[model samples]
Target: MAPPTTGRLSALLRRCASAGALSPGAQLHAQALVAWRLPDVTLETDLVLFYCRCGALPHARQVFDTMTPSPSMHAYNVLLAASPPSAALGLLSRLLAAGLRPDRYAIPAALRACAELRDALLGAALHGFAVRLGLFSNVVVSGALLGMYAKAEVLDDAVRVFDEMPEKDTVVWNCMVTGYARAGRAKDALDLFWKAQVEAVNMVRDVRAVPSVLNICAKEGELMKGREIHGRMVRILAFDRDVAVGNALVDMYAKCGRVDGARAVFAGMKERNVVSWSTLISCYGVHGRGQEALRVYKEMVSQGVKPNCVTFTSILSSCSHSGLVTDGQRIFESMSKVYSVEPAADHYACMVDLMGRAGAIEEAVGFIRKMPMEPSASVWGALLSACAMHNNVDVGEIAAYRLFELEEGNASNYVTLCGIYDAAGRSDDVAGLRSRMRELGMVKTPGCSWVDVKGRACAFYQGSVPRYLRRRIVWVLDRLLEDMGGSESEDGHTNIYYDYELIRP
Candidate 1:
């Protein structure tokens, strides 16, 4: 039952390739020279592929160069595809100049390479080649071409290619949608989604399709539109929930100020992932419900959902808003010990804010010194705000000076420093900082807040609001206390102090 020597070597080489035993494979290749003979072109190609797969590019090239005959089109394509995208263009060009006819398999990768390089010229040439070779009918190759052109920001050409596609699949549509959105054409992308919905009822119901359009809607703040899309999704994917879709839904509602709706969707899901928890927790943080956000974090832990970097950011933000210093510290330490999540600059900023809010300026300073990374402007800004709150002129000066060093033109740093100095009655210091800010060409960003009232909305700037609305506010407050149950004070100030014995009189 002894096998022939030539077949035996081939089988051994294939086995090595299968098992990914690169060293043993090389040794076997060496043994083949003595034990059997030089392997056939097919076996040699397999060995080259095995080496390439094992990341032994040098050995693969050595095998390739020594091929008994020049390698076939397939061989060139494999090596070209395996090389890094940026470097692969040269290898592919060499293959083309050598008069090798790139087959259907080769075109997709070439298009992918062009996409990675953002080389629209090469990608267009490949697309034309695909058309001439009649491989343009293939969905995957066409999709790659669309994605490549989109990556290069050649949207018109990408769209032309897409329209020419006789059979557009979901992937092709998805690429165009994502491409348009990434190119900052949210309106155009949404129009495409609508077109897809009208043209293909099945695509509208597709889960992947839903998430892409929903993402666009989320970014554009089109809440009412997002609501309609969510309704359709609920009807279609009722029993089948996708984590991505749920996350997007949570984010959309949270961004639009419907935290309750977001929470409801989150609660109704039978399966909750880490993003889901993070989204809901962040919503609470944004809405100033730090306690509720903290509770959600604890609940996520109880359910064994691991926290990631984003999760820690949300947790720290919650602590900062609620002024929960002890809770923030406990969670920050546990990030490494329990959750195994490394703290990043964002987490450090939150920690500084938490400490600063609690008037623990010295502790915050000490914590910043121990940070594993350099303090970013955001971290310094938080500390400066805290110093302003606590009237700590000394530390405020230090933080402001550091901030000025980091970013000389940051007007907020100067404003915050001036606030601290002004509160301390350091008029000259305030004037100096303002002059310095002006010299640096730093202009203060205006502060504005939006208030919704009785089906109408208005925004108030730092120095002005609509005159009628301001008058109405005063009139309402004046009326609310006009008939109050109180005895007039004998002196100038109104006195509402309660004395039990006086009540008996």
Candidate 2:
């Protein structure tokens, strides 16, 4: 009940930090201060760590800064680990200025801040510093450096660090995969996942790779490979026991156009969280199963799994896809009033799309005008897309004007506005817009599509097909058109989505 001595008080502070008992920890500090019983460095470190763990940064800093000889480097580590990027880097500077070399813990924490800030120069400097201090040999330090480079989009440096590491562990592997993903190298991520599995044949299989691998499979729509990975996960390990793996499985199945599979995985999971429910709802929403998504949302609420912001976004997106105007309106109203979840930009954008798609363009505009915050680019883009769909040239022009201000370099906005004018027979306006786009050096990006053939995923972009494929694919298409008794205009044209050829190897 009482901290009778310094040693006992230090232990109690650690216990409070572990339990995140902020109130009791604060009272103990007050008692220490009033009694003029200043704690030793270890006790001071414990006090700072206690407050940091409890998210009381102000209190942590106060105790840390007031130390007679300054706090230990370890004390600075605790604060930096919990502080924001700017604050963490500031503390790291203080550590350097104090002329104390940072240990493995402080280095990784500082590297994490660099990754978040995307400060590649500082991260590279830290990498050099770690090498000089001999922490470069530490597996954790290597992994942190790899993660920092990956997050900064410097994949070459990340890969070099990853390859040079004497011992590769799950942490570094996940970091590499996620780095590839964040850098838009989805195929590279999948290749690394495959490579890791091959290497793990002689070592311990890392179940941690499942989520990242599954996500890559989802993005690529490689259902066959995803299923194969699922089998391996089940046989080599009991991966279903891990909630994160289960959630990724659901997401992967859903993203790859298998709602039934996603639903089955959700049903089989022994544990569920807000993410589990939200992922299912999102898959259903994405697939235009608005009614099912709504049912799931109701079930989630009834089961006392309070809907989070993601749940609302998924459900609102569902209504937008299905044109469920009334349901969307009810849910949007309830977000702030009943649920106390303020509508984010995403939610506001979804509402505009919902109303605009349902042929209530005027109402959607009015909603945008009365929004609590300034309309984001997404909100205006949604309105512009809807106007293009409905051939509302005047409203389309207004939305396009706002979008040009918001995203001056976005070619899609210009293309959509040009389409609206073309649809309304405004040839002069279309020509002028085309001229403007050309002057701005804004060429429309080619559409890309992925094809999965016998476990191999191939990506093809418009107008970038091989000459052999184009000829053979056109010939095959012409034959199919002749067989189907198709119209003359449709014959001999490659499918717009892809210029695919089905030649046997």
Candidate 3:
């Protein structure tokens, strides 16, 4: 049989690559070699792309290196995109050495590789190269550069890139806003979002920006801002039906301690995906509504939605928090046997937590021994926490020893061990642990909580408040307590007040 024409073969290779048929792509490559002693550059490039798409980097390199004349910039870009960040940088260097000028396409691909690798130096060098080549202003290249800087957590550089860009397209704006959110500069992200709104940029048109801000609100516990964004989404008649947006909204509300709001969003969604289901189950789990979480999981399975690893993790977490040991164990086994989902370390950690929480100390230790892989810090931490809760000093010490070896710098592990010793009346051991911690210069991280008031977030730290604001804050709190019929204990700590109207004051 005669091989197809070059054009026909190129089309076939594209289809195989798109379909991710590695074996078929390799067979096609062999057939092309047999058909043409010296295939055209286009065919050769196509073969490289096919191999790259199939993750056959070695074959891609072979095709690239064996080309009679050096490959085109397009070929280099394809290889760069296929390679890891370091390899991509190496390819860019080779392109420069070969006297091939990188065009708009090649520069952005290399920048993206740098971003993923978080190599700030390499990314900055690529930015310089793009500027020298006069390709920096290209919309795509500028967007990639901004994203690279953002991923590297060089927010100032990202802002500079944004400010210098001659044209600010929606993609550019989205990148900057998302970057600020990811860097925990939530105010900056919200400011930019409102700025975009004032400029009438139709932010809802950029589907990516909404989720980024929603995530920021979630992290900062800014429920007011989150609801405002949700209202905007509804007004625009946008993202109400988008599964990703819906999932984000649900997560935001859940993280803010508003399970009812999250549940409302979940219930109102016209369509739901695995993420939507998982987020809702996670919400219930976190709020200690384990039975409700398990119910949702069953409903998801009944609706034919396939649960992924995250879904299992959430459900297992629910079981652990709810003290449903038997249920957790059943689900853990079913993950591999019934669902064919291999239990990752997280799943094992959850299982250990479940056993520990249920006071099965010996079983939990035995479970760790039976794991296919080495137990991680989380696994040991779970055991240690259980020991503290149950006053099991022996097991607690063992878990603490493993934890100290695993996470030497985590002061919380040492603190937890000290607490266990104190509870067991082992003052000597507790003092020794504290002395060791002090010698090692370890300090416990301060506990902090955040509340959103009138669209602003206020973070409060344990045992500390700014002296300047202390008087005014105390006066306001006194008024709030008076209004709520609250009384102070002998130690001057306020007793619980069920009325939430105190928040309004």
Candidate 4:
């Protein structure tokens, strides 16, 4: 006889799922099976659910597939939802071949799998199915639909689903906000956030806001608007003391060139996370203060705040900008052993940059080869740049070849290779690369830099004559470059001294 149903199994399942204890859940599932005899469909379904919730989709499928051939719609749904896009697609195709009709609950989860796989073609067919069954109006179904369109970058379709909704909730609002922000429609995202605020106040009496909304404002770089939102949070005490809100504020201020404001906010925070440390470090790195970034990193370490991948990336960027190659190598070496954090692609790219900027072209190339994963175009691009810096024409050629293979659509690779050839006085190679670029209809863009004077920002483009500049500025630069030209040039190469004069003046 089946053992009487009890809270023990249910509670254990919930705990294992919540904690991502997949192996333990499987063991408990085995125990539950032995604890009962002639287990009913409900118990089998519960077991399937345990594996699904634990993200052990393969195990879920094993249990679900072996169950009686006459599977419940819920069983099919679990399989469809638990599997990834490729797995889900194969399962759905098999289910159709078996002549089983999909239930309403199963369809949305399947659609979500399509979205995850970015299989927009399959997602479109699922949309039609939902519409034909009049299930498109279901709130959960509609939200999943919106997610699909958003992932596919089909803003119009997503907006249509959002518009057709009879009611909207914070989750729906968040989804749209995230979509617009990711699509680079920052202003539109900010507008939607405002609308969500008004809707919250009027329709939902118990509606509470989340810090993720503040993150949207930060992403848009509307500093003034973000400040106003922060003010609102303070007035209503809506996440005023939340760690995430504080972190968002710090990140916003730092990215907006108000690092002092960021520092002030960081000082006031009740608790600090690795993100908070990374944000400030990135600010210092961007401002060309590698030493200050390192100092802050030290303070974080002393306070027992572990440096995450982002924090290390920021510091690596600082090292690259300030030419701290040795320090960068130390951090890179310590990352895996000291912190036990596995290096991601970005970390590898930073290391390449560090070695490249320090004129360690060979070391950088070797690092790329030793990388466990395939080196991306950015990684090769960094090595290419380093080769150019050290005038390693042979290595530059190889790096350029790899980069071209990786990203044929981007024309920057050819241009960079041509410039390196020209710089090294390889006239024949330079001419050949230039002709190829012309054939491909690619043009090299001039380098440009911007500097803020008082409150205004001004740009200077390479090879472009400056106009309306103070006569004193032009006179000083003319003399400085002329003096440096005689002193700094070797053969035909010219190395100017504008960097020093600009700082001193």
Q: Model 3 over residues 263-323: C-alpha lDDT tens digits?
A: 9999988888899999999999997888899999999999998889999999999999999
lDDT of each: 0.81, 0.87, 0.87, 0.76
RMSD of each: 8.6, 5.8, 5.9, 7.8
Tens digit of per-residue lDDT, candidate 2, span 160-255: 998899887778877888888777787888788878776744323667767877888887787887898888778866556878988999999999
In order, how many clashes per candidate?
0, 0, 0, 0
Candidate 1 residue-wise lDDT, 5-26, digit = tens: 7666668777877788888888
Q: Candidate 4: where is the Cα deviation over 4 Å?
A: 1-39, 50-63, 66-69, 77-83, 86-103, 201-221, 236-244, 341-352, 355-380, 383-410, 413-433, 445-505
lDDT, residue 124, candidate 2: 93
- Regions more than 4 Å wrong, model 3: 1-63, 77-87, 200-202, 453-457, 465-505
- True-structure lDDT of candidate 2: 0.87
- The candidate that wins on lDDT is 3
* Residue 148 displacement (Å), model 2: 2.0
Error of 3 at 362 (Å): 3.3
Model 3 clash tally, residue pairs = 0
lDDT of 4 by residue, 1-505 (tens): 5543545676776678778888887777777777762245555666678888877777778777777645566777877787877788787777777788766777778778877888778888988888888887888888888888888888888899899987776677778877877677766777887788787434222223334455655554556777877676666654335677777877777766566767777787777788888888888788677888889989999999999989999999998888888888899889999999888888899999888988888888889999999998889999988888888899999999999889876788888888899889999998888788788787767776666465344776765543445456667777876777677333232444345333232
TM-score of candidate 3 versus the correct structure, residues matched by position = 0.82
